[model samples]
Target chain A: MRSTVREADRPWARQGAGQHEGRFALLLLLPAAVVVFGVVIWPVVRTLVVSLYDVDSAMPGSYPFVGLDNYVRVFQDDRFYTVLGHTMYFTLVSTFLELALGIAVALLLNAPLRARWLWRSIVVLPWALPTIVNGALWRWIYNGQYGALNGLLDTLGISETPTQWLGEPFLALNMVIIADVWKNTSIVVFFILAGLQTIPSDLYEAARVDGAGPWRAFWRLTIPMLAPSIAVVLILRTIEAFKVFDIIYVMTGGGPASGTQTIAFYTYLQAFSNQLFGYGAALAYLIVLAVFALAMVYLRILKQNQLAGVE
Target chain B: MKPTSPSSGSIAGIIAPRPTRRGLLVGGSALGLSGLLVACGVGGGGGKKGGGGSGSGSIRALFMQQAGYSEENIQEMTAAFMKANSGIKVTADFVSYEALHDKTVAAAPAGTYDVVLIDVIWPAEFGTKNIVADVTDRWPDDWKQQMLGGAVTTPQYDGKFYGVPWILDTKYLFYNTAQLEKAKVDAAELDTWDGVLTAARALKESGVKYPLIWSWQQAEALICDYTQLLGAFGGTFLDDAGQPAFNQGGGVAALEFMRQTIVDGLTNPASTQSLEEDVRRVFSSGQASIALNWTYMYGLANDPKESQIPGDVAVLQTPAGPVGRPGVNGSMALALTATSENQDAGWKYIEYLTSQPVQDKYALSSLPVWESSYDDPKVVETNPAVVPQAKKQLGDMILRPQVASYNAMSQVLQAEIQKALLGDKEPQQALDDAASEAAKLLES
Candidate 1:
């Protein structure tokens, strides 16, 4: 009887009550497992397979198996490089601006104030708006003829002419980043605000006892404490900025000489508009590889911060 | 998958007679993935059509929104068609014109739509791709003679009828009579491109900042506007052998003419980023004195509720160049999707919609494709300002190059042309760049 009990200790031996618990857990997990496998795993693997072929149409037909050629083509194409440059510029600028602005606003929101809820709600309005609506709103504001931005500028006696904000390529890209930061900084602020609440007043008091001022205390105590949160927001915003598409679609449509085209938007143009599905799939995988590398960096920084806290 | 002990992980469980439950999970996923990959490989193999159905089932159709026909108008027409043909029920879906092409392409493999409204430029791509059915055999011979000459060619590709023309349209020169008169510029001078420029200068001198606004945004609208000017300058999109010819002779001249307008500040700098709707708004608001847009603009620009200077708006055929004037063909057609299961019912629905009586009834919303509708007193009365202009403009129309890869080529040209319009490149250099890029697209 004792030997029989020992046999159950072997992993997956299926001879005792532990087997039931394992099976029950699996049973409970089946729905979520199916969802992840069907929508996420399956499509990802299928796209990988498609990237190996020379597919030109959505309708099924004979297509030559050209392994790695499509991926190779992505590097060779001139427009790919052009769009990649635009995407990198957009991501870096937008993410940096969001982080800086998010921190400042988060500090403000975390401060003791009258009607804090009303202030927070008003600040959250832009973030609560759907990206499509935000994009359309900004497009209206940037309209060369009658945009509100120009109207305001004229009212303030700042300019004599209505500038065509979206008429130039580089300028259009920067303008889109401003629109993105304006909306996304809200999410970043909420994250930092939550991080702020987790901090104890003892740290600031202790810093004061050590003869440090408010600015030094903040830099020494608040920032270090918020490293984990900053790392989290950084990763989320970085990945999101890399995948930007819809706002550009609604606002610029990748126009003014394709000045504002990002990697995702270009992928869409290739797959749906140009019907080059295989090439588009290859581009998607490259994006995954790039994002994977980025995530690794973020995780390492998060782990380092955790270790420092533990010390 | 949940994180478990590595010693009892999926790979180990499968290899060691499933040491852990993780093995079972991993093994199952691998099997499923392999199966899916196999299925996908088969789909990429040669496949047969799945478009046959009993001609009487309910069919779904796709149409454009806020353009040729409003969603309300198309739905009303569909309801009328269903009432007449009691055996068939039609479901209509509408998307903006900007999304129409991609939406149709994405829906093809699934047979999600039985019929789709396609633009005039899509026949070449859709016919060759087997996305839309060729209906040349089913097309009535007499119907060809009945439709206007330009309308008849809307869906023709490589000697086959891919669709039936439904919405007939073209860009016409619309002007503000009040602004032109205030500038002392004769309306008669608007008949020629040269005279139109002189008129623009006069309008500018009279305090009109910009006298001309065009639908020159980076879209198909820009290509349409360009095609009109290309034709007026005696340029062909492709030479007889089908090589890129737009880089030579009249093509270069036409682009230069466009650039000069921008330099002179006679054409709105905003025109580089404006679509047809924007053109209408500026012209109607008296910010612009002369513009080019579709027939629909005439109705809206002359309506008091929509426009500030309603009574001052007038319409004319596109102005002549050094050569002759030819308007860009901006037509749409109804086509049976290649993957549709109920082609017979779909054809019946299309036939009813394109019928003269139905189209004539909707003349207030969109122009009729039938030439005889122009002669009808009621149709003329529906849009008196535009009907006479349409009679002349619709007779001479220029089509974008009928090529399978026209969309990609158009995108390249749009970007290059924009570069020229914005002063980043010379017009000659821009078209030359576009021509070289087009050559590669044609080869593929």
Candidate 2:
């Protein structure tokens, strides 16, 4: 009777071994799933939930569910639109300037210039410096009374009086962009230089044989080949510029009026300065949507360009 | 051997007897969950133990950045407090003015601080939210007369005092004595807005280029400057019914006067971007003949090591306008938090920090809130020019609205005033917009 009972459980036991291996695999993956759920998924859900309520920090338990009213208020705010315009202006102008300067510098670095290694090393120092340090450095350089820039302009006989680089509205944004370009162009240069290195020498030789000058070869071969790298830089810089706060906060405090108040600065003012968390959250989500849409457009362009290149 | 069915006896049955797959899965999952739960429980327990046990003896105090309230001074004060209270320890933290209110609001709920440096205008919000404890009956019987009347009342909400006023502060009109003498303008003639502008004209004639420098940056300083001017012109920001009335009365005239200062080049065009420190630097550098700045600049400008014009500085009452001479209170106070576990120790620390002797010691850097400290020998000797003017200014000082909504109101007013200053909007339209927006914020 003992032998018969053992025989009956044998098939079930053999099958259990194979199934237990699968169970072990799932157990290994459980911690990773828990971490992803906690870290990535949770805050997003919380932000969304909080966005739909009028959250008063002083009265914690008394948040009223306001549906989409907060979003409506953000849209109705004139400051929101003004800030959005300024953000776009800053992103496009700064990114374009960075890209243009970056390509030129990268090409120079690629050339057989004297002390090429030293130049390559020194070019990245600006990018390596802390952003706060850069902001402070530029602030002193652009001071209306005691700025190096004003001193230079005076010495060069550019203007008689000091230009209020950070006080005038258009001038302030342009000055911030100049500082941003000085700090960020090096990153673009690094990326493009790497991309330039990946291109085959024979392609340039073929273009040269086809009676193309350096400028034409750059237009026809260099740019087309470097499209992917440029797209990546554009997408990264656009996202970064869209969310810029620190430089503006440090340089101008979004001031001389709200001339430099980007969407991010305005959102911070709403959420922290005004203590209007609901409105700020709604504004944040709108920024997220805008950024997501921008990213999608860049990705599509990259894909299409690759497809055209392949064909 | 043939693949054996478990139901029948075979070699496979003897080699592979095992637990069922379902049982193994359930057991493994339970073990993993329990491990995670145990880890979380351990962390939480450790945190609670730290907060409830050893941390109960030490208190943390948060302060806003100020000249007299340096980290070194704070450490000395903390050391003195700890020395007096044998077993207690105090930790200090400092934040800049821009981040002070926000940081305190965020930190208070977490019980992160036991004592906080409260802005004079913040008691209404802090008291209304129960962020700080009420100490209405804590003062000694003679405290009412001992402290300045405004200082005593500035931190009260609902007839309850929430803090002890520490620094007695207000704005002052500072001038370069050499520049005034060079321009041949009597200091008494520079007692009104017109007089200031006329003096600017005289200083300009004497080749000073920019005669009046203002701390007109679009920040709390701008609001302070505007409010002082508004009060000087006999304007009230809020009505008897607790409504915004800044756009009415002499508000436009006050704003226009500020705008004209820039327009007439009496103030540096760059003054629109200059903070109080910037204006002080401009004055100390002898680039400007007159400056409107905090009382701290007076001390700095007189010190030979700190000032370029050490022998050529004078401070006076914030010049009078159409109605009277008025200044805005920039006083800061210390408050005990309700959430602190060691409230008694926190109160002791505050009491010692604000005591007359300690305050007198700190008076060279920060004016003492106690009215009697002005007569303290050291204070009188160190800051002789500042004491009498500060005493007189503290008497006529007007307070910005002390309400829960003052921060939001100040922000709106600042933006509107900045627009007018930047030439984006006319003064009347700017005030009207600010009035309407601030009214809505107050209502909500």
Off by over 4 Å in 1: A1-15, A301-311, B1-52
Query: How far out, in Å, is residue A300 in model 1?
Result: 2.9
The C-alpha lDDT values of all candidates are 0.89, 0.82
| Residue B193, model 2, lDDT | 75
- Scored against the true structure, residue B291 in model 2 reaches a CA lDDT of 85
Best by TM-score: 1
| CAPRI-style quality class for the chain A–B interface of candidate 2 | incorrect
The residue-level lDDT of candidate 2 at B234 comes to 86
- Per-residue lDDT over A96-210 for candidate 2, one digit per residue giving the tens place of the 0 to 100 score: 9999999999999999899999999899999998888999899889988888999999999998798888877778988999999999999999999999999999988988999
lDDT of 1: 0.89
Please give me the DockQ of candidate 2 compared with the native complex. Answer: 0.19
What is the lDDT for B93 in model 2?
A: 92
What's each prediction's clash count? 3, 3
lDDT, candidate 1, B1-444, per-residue tens: 122343755676655763358877886777676657745663565443645477788999999875567788899999999888899999999987889999999999888899999999999999988899999988999999999999999999999999999999998999999888888999999999999999999999999998889978888988888888999999889999998999887888888899899999999988888888789888888899999888788878888998999899998999999888999999999999998889999999999999999999888778999989999999999888888989999999998999988988999999999999888999989999999999999998
- Candidate 2 wrong stretches, greater than 4 Å: A1-39, A58-60, B1-56, B137-142
